[model samples]
Target: MTVADVQLFVTSAVGGAMVGETVEGIARYPINLRYPQSWRDSPQALRQLPILTPMKQQITLADVADVKVSTGPSMLKTENARPTSWIYIDARDRDMVSVVHDLQKAIAEKVQLKPGTSVAFSGQFELLERANHKLKLMVPMTLMIIFVLLYLAFRRVGEALLIISSVPFALVGGIWLLWWMGFHLSVATGTGFIALAGVAAEFGVVMLMYLRHAIEAEPSLNNPQTFSEQKLDEALYHGRGPARAPESDDGGGDYRWSAADSVWNGSRFRGDEPDCRADDWRHDHRAFAIAVYYPGGI
Candidate 1:
């Protein structure tokens, strides 16, 4: 017999058997097996079974078929309707970035994928990468908005640029505090930094306004008001702008703006030298330090 004839005969004998008898539907009842055709149950027994082909010849099932024991996957997984395998990492002491980096390096060095095969990273690493990409687009936009608003408020490019420069200083404290609290460089941390930068710009604007108001409220620049450093200090102490001085838990005020002494003393309204420059250096340096130091207190 041919392979096809033998295959069909063996398939009918082994798999196509059906012995039927009536059983209980709702109430219990006895049912007897009408035809118990259990001869083709085992593979080893089926090998000895004889098959009658179309050529009127009898042959054993083993003449056409090869049967053996083997092992295969018990379960399979898929992604997007295509077969896939997953590798998971459980990080305890290691950071996600370094782990993912090392894994990718190892994969590139040791594993050779066939054509049409690909690999991708997901979970927290993927989320972080996406957040960083968004920050790359959003951070510059945020800074530009701050710059434009500062320029509009101050009506001077130099002043706006100065205030904007304080932004990085404002973020330092937030970043340090987040790290101390076991927070990584995430989207939430980045958002906090952006908000803090705005606050820094607000501080700069308020300080500038204080100086402007004090100068405007003083006697005219051409009139030349005579005042010593002590009087100028008093003016700065009392003539602060709309922003109230930050008070400690003990109700004392912080003297962060005390560096304004040189600025008040060297003002044109105070009738100092036209060439005299205020301690601009002191303002930026102190503001940066304050910005970096204050968030922890909050």
Candidate 2:
């Protein structure tokens, strides 16, 4: 028989009779099985299926088409309505950005793409790029806000600028600490640096304010009486500072305390009296406050 005649006969009679036709929605939540499951469960069973019937003009599937069993991809993937496959490369002991950068460079140098095929570096690299873009805008905005707030607080452009300048110094220490701790600069690290900058700026402002107050309230050495209580208030902010001088370590009549002796033994009172250690004074909040406020002996 001719190829078309054989094809028509085999499709209609033998294979169709054995395999049966698939019907959808034949029953509610049920599959309609015209043939048993064992009919074509294996390649051997499929090959042994009857392709010819005795009563009809004889035809065989072998005469019409070539059918050879072989293995193929279990599943296919598509992206953007086009067939695609992923080749994943993982990073260990290296940064994702640098790895992706080197990959792009190498691919550009050595690899060639076909007409319909393409490649992309995604995952962490894509996320990092997005984060960097956001930070680019956020960093400048944060700095502007800090400058404006400092200017409002200090009421002087010079003081604001000076305080803001210390932010970088604070960031240097933070960056170094991060590096020492074996951490890469990420969003969290940037956030911590921002916090550090705020604290550094605050300290700068406080120091500048104290210096300005001291300079404004300086007393002349010519007349001791001219240093009134008002001048003392101006210097110490209305008795907020030390009320009494830190005593000397020496009781050698009018002898003075050495820096080392003061730090080691603390201040001494009268002869043969028990002394408070410098370490104790440091730990005691009241003693610390007294020492800081009164650098000179009363």
Candidate 3:
């Protein structure tokens, strides 16, 4: 008999019945017919299996084909057409960066690779590395753009720089909150900080606008010779023009006014306070206003 005939006979006998079915009530069940377990228990039993040829002659399977057990993979996996092995790690109660850092160090110290063998780390850590590289370029560009926009809006380098400087003070609370919550720095946190910076800059701009409008509305405060720290402080506290009316009900105006009062009170209540003039008081007022309003964005 041909190899195909032998293969078909052996497979049909051992692979169980394909066309048998049983009906019970309205349900149907498949039937698998094969040699009894005792008759097909080992390699020798399988080897002695009978096969029929077209000539009506019976021959044993061992006469045509070899049947023996051996060891090999049931399934093979490959990457880039090369066989690969995978190692999976799960980090718990710690940050992924630190875990991976320790893992890399351990591997470097303990594992050695043969020629043509190399190890590459991937997954979330890979994405983090890529994001970090992008942020290095993106963050400074973002700050520069914000500064440029602030400069465009105010047309003054000092004011733009002032707003930019306020961003760090804005971020301090968020950084502390993250620390309290046991959060590690990541891409998500970096993006949040960028957004916070923008908001801080906006608050600074609003505070500057309020101060400028208050000074402009009172012609006396604009004149250098007439300007005094006490007069400026009074003007800042009670400066309610058309610009202040709409913001009063919105909570922002009250916050800004209260912030100004806090700075004035801080300076007025201090026994060892220096005799700072109007410029220093104005600077302190601006800084205090920014500190108070910055949290509103969060």
By TM-score, who's the top model here?
Answer: 3
Residue 207 miss distance in model 2 (angstroms)? 4.5
lDDT of candidate 2 over 1-298, digit per residue (tens):
5567656654544344443444567643433333344745655444444555445544445544666777976789887899877778888766678888998999889999998878887777898888889988987888899899999997988777766665664455445444554546655555545554564455455545654556355754225867675565455542323222222221121122322453555445311111212212212322233234332211
Ranking by lDDT: 3, 1, 2
Name the runs in model 2 displaced over 4 angstroms: 1-35, 47-71, 206-298
* Tens digit of per-residue lDDT, candidate 3, span 91-154: 8777678899998898899999888777777888899899999999988998999999999999
Task: List ranges where model 1 is wrong by over 4 Å.
Answer: 1-75, 78-82, 110-116, 220-233, 239-242, 245-298
Count of residue pairs whose backbone atoms collide, per candidate: 0, 0, 0
Clashing pairs in 3: none
Residues 51-155 of candidate 1: C-alpha lDDT, one tens digit per residue = 666787787777778766679666788877878777787776555777889989999999999997988888988987888899899889988999999988879
C-alpha local distance difference test of each model: 0.58, 0.53, 0.67
- Top candidate (lDDT): 3
TM for every model, in the order presented, reads: 0.55, 0.56, 0.62
Candidate 2 vs. true structure, TM-score: 0.56
Taking all chains together, the TM-score of candidate 1 against the true structure is 0.55
